[model samples]
Target chain A: EPEVTQTPSHQVTQMGQEVILRCVPISNHLYFYWYRQILGQKVEFLVSFYNNEISEKSEIFDDQFSVERPDGSNFTLKIRSTKLEDSAMYFCASSGQGVTYEQYFGPGTRLTVT
Target chain B: AQRVTQPEKLLSVFKGAPVELKCNYSYSGSPELFWYVQYSRQRLQLLLRHISRESIKGFTADLNKGETSFHLKKPFAQEEDSAMYYCALSGRGSARQLTFGSGTQLTVLP
Candidate 1:
């Protein structure tokens, strides 16, 4: 079974610094999403990307956050200026074109903004 | 707005014991429900979806539309069932992004 893959399993950065999390979704998948879970909190949806544009985003996805599918296989999330509250486990997920509801998740990247 | 609530923060049961994790949602329109499980150091994996109505790894969940609840149940939970379970909901049509609950940490003791 093909699985979503993320790079830099753990990231530590100073407050106000920029950070970018990278993911490579499963081949042939079209719908991509970004979610985050603060320690001991529920997983919160950030944004969803499809056809090279943002399909939907939650209120939590503010101007500081941006997502890009720079290449055919690579999807990335960039935080312009990190805050301490931004520290969380960031997960990348994807689903096939037909079955967009069934998402496959990557082993999240743990971001720590100190 | 959409919201998912998993009432139990933690639950434990001995091996082979029946287990249930409660979930409720607040959505105006028709919604799709799903249960995702995450084991130690593993990525979140889909356990079951309300639309499918199929059992996976001895677990089943029935969506009660009237009550706006979709609770996960297992007749006999094994030790390997210990994991964090999240109940998620998504609205139909274009807005399909998931809204997840706080998640329940289930420990199946041996």
Candidate 2:
């Protein structure tokens, strides 16, 4: 079965630095999303991207966060300035164009900001 | 606002015993509910969806709109059933975005 793939399974960055977490969603999927989970916390939605634009975003996805589909398969989330609280497991998910289609999740990238 | 609640942080059951993972949601509009499981070292994957109304790997979940719950259940649990299960919800307006619960870690002891 085809699955979503993410790069840099784990990353360590300094505070105030920028980091990009990349994901290659299933080839045929049309909608992409980004979610994060702080250690011991529930998964939180960050943003959703479709048609090269952001569909919705949460308060956590503030000015420092941005998502881009620079290529057909690549969906990238960039944090302009990383903070200690920004450390978490970031997951990328994608789904087909139907309302009932379940979103497939990637292995997730663990971001650690010191 | 849409929210998912999985009250149990951990549940342990012996093999061959029945297992039930509770999930409740709060959403004004109709919402889509799903159960995702993640085994150790594996990525989170969809286990079942309420709309399908089908069983997967001997597990089934019924969407109780009156109770606003979609609890997952299996009649007989196996050792392989040990994993972290999350209850998620997607509202009509934000179908692509999912709000997940804190998750329940089920351990099926042999």
Q: Model 1, A1-114: lDDT tens per residue?
A: 899999899999999999999999998888999999999899999999999999999999999999999979999999999999999999999987655559999999999998
lDDT of 2 by residue, A39-109 (tens): 99999999999888999999999999999999788999999999999999999999998653679999999
What is the alpha-carbon lDDT for the whole of candidate 2? Answer: 0.94
User: For every model in order, what is the iRMS?
Assistant: 0.9, 1.2
Query: What DockQ results for candidate 2?
Result: 0.79
The local lDDT score (0 to 100) that residue A76 gets in candidate 1 is 98
For model 1, the docking class works out as high
What stretches of model 2 exceed 4 Å from their correct place?
Answer: none
**Candidate 2 residue-wise lDDT, B58-105, digit = tens:** 999999999999999999999999999999998877445899999999
- Candidate 2 at residue A61, lDDT? 96
Question: Model 1: runs farther than 4 Å from truth?
Answer: none
TM-score of each: 0.98, 0.98
